[model samples]
Target: MIQRLNVNTEVLSTYIRNSNTPIEYLRQKLPNIDKFLKGELEPTFNQVYALSKLINIPTGLLLLKEPISASSLNVDFRTFNSELLSDISSELKDTIIEMQEKQEFLKEIVENECPFVGIFTFDDDYSDVILKAKELLGNEITRKRFDNYRKILGQLGIFIFLNGKYKDNTHRPLNLNEFRGFVLSDKKAPIIFINQLDSKTGQFFTLIHEFVHLLYGDSDLFDGEDSKKRSKTEAIINSITAEILVPKELISDMFDNQIDIRTSLDSLSRKFEVSKFVILRRLYDLSMLSRKDFMSLQNELEAEFKLIENIKKNSGGGNYHNNLLFRMDSNFFNHVNNAVQQNKITYTDAFGIVGVGYKGYKILSRGG
Candidate 1:
């Protein structure tokens, strides 16, 4: 006779509700789910294991007497609309946990040598914070800065990852509108993950925004919303990011004379290596653009950005290996490779840490 195990009905219900799986699907999988829920029948170990796999919950949790309550993530999701919180899928949560585990491993081995991870304090003024960040970055925002931003972050002992799709289901891509970036604050090993599906300029801004969260030692998610209507903490960080990217004095110098708004915006965007949205915000902030003109240009720029994004999506096929290296950060790759070379970790373990297979690892090893 097969031994039956008592499963917590409340925990099972809560897991199913929180997960992407449907109730009907669960009912189909466990034909006697109703009986189980009613406490009329106990679940077999196999049934419990299958339910765990389906809902992405640990089987051990189901065996508990009481329902397990999930701990809050300590992340503030900045959004105009609260509904976007629902988009935080199980895959995303699992990805974050996995990244944290990897970060812990790195911290254990390399924390002593890395001193820049928790250099900033929340008590520091935004101006001072920005200056220190730039000093650590080794340069101000420029046309080529994006290429080296990740390297700078890595040098500061911040691990950054870029992923467009859910780790478990590649078919379901992460929605950029829901969250552009998130930072997990740890003194020894802070981590930031950016949604690569966002526009390049948007990604740059998100990096800075998330970095600001790390500076304050706050774990949070930044949904690319209007900077004007930000929360108090977000407003402070947004102002800092703007000033760091486009200094008021520098922008004032650029707009000394009257010129075509469109032409000047294009020129300034290229010069500052930021989105037109950011450039326009600076201009509006400096009283350079009239409110009416600012609103008009903002709408125009957003439409154009969407069109360009759609065009790029249509023109597919990019180098997967190089892109992986970029998402993983070159400095991160170097650290992992160094660890492997020093026999601290095997190549297989390195591959797992880097989120690549043997062939992909070979390509990354070749610096492709």
Candidate 2:
């Protein structure tokens, strides 16, 4: 006899309502999904487990006594109190759940606390924070600015994952508008995720912002665009991030009001190794650019950024192993491998933690 489970059809329906996954694709994975959704058939244990893994939600959610929500209100967009954070696209939720599960596992075996975590309070002077950031930089290496930052951050115990899509699922691309990046804060294994879908320099700027969030030892979701919902913490983090990216004193010394605004934006971006928008925003914050002029230039820059991103997206990627480093945290990768070697975690367990199978893991180990 097949053991059937009483799955909440209402909750299942709500979860799949706005899912980016096509209904036909889901049917391929769980052929009885239509019946399950309609309450025509209670799914079996195997069916519930298959649905959980496919949708990136916990299996226990399917067994809930009642739907988590009283109604579908705000289930589509709002962030919820649950750690599962189920309302987002499976891609985003999957990535979050994967990184976090690995972090939790690492905490058991890793003993060292990162000195930089919780180094400063939110109210602390940003100028002082910049000095601390510079201290972390030590001797500045002249290179691609963000690449240098990514290297040092990983070495310093902050794991960096930069990607425009979810894992290697090319079909499921990330949306920067919904979220630019997020930080998962841990003293020993903090994680920084950048949605590379943003403009090139915009990604770097977000890296800095998420780094700041890590310093506070707090997990935060960042939306880089201007919004009515931005909090005091976000405002402070942005201010500090902007100042750190393009220091006021440095800009004041180099900026020439007589230079054409367009020319100045280009020059300053190159000089500071930041995006044109960052340069413009810093200038605007300094009252160096008129509100009317800033608004006009901002729209122009946004369009240019989008066009460049589209062109790059069309012409991107071939090296798979090389990409494993950017998409998965290298330091964490080694630690997971080490655990596998000691029999602390099985190869299967390692695969689940890193979100890859045997062949992919082999490729990643070559590049880890």
Q: lDDT of all the models against the reference?
A: 0.70, 0.71
Error of 1 at 102 (Å): 2.2
Against the true structure, what is every candidate's RMSD?
9.4, 9.3
Give the TM-score of each candidate.
0.72, 0.73
Local distance difference test, candidate 1: 0.70
Local accuracy of candidate 2 as per-residue lDDT tens digits, 188-208: 778887776766677788788
- TM-score: model 1 vs. ground truth: 0.72
Q: How many residue pairs clash in each candidate?
A: 0, 0
Candidate 1 lDDT at 304 equals: 95
lDDT of 1 by residue, 102-198 (tens): 5545554554444544566656777788887677765555557776776677767777888887532357677766667777777766778887887
Off by over 4 Å in 1: 1-87, 113-124, 139-142, 167-169, 221-230, 338-348
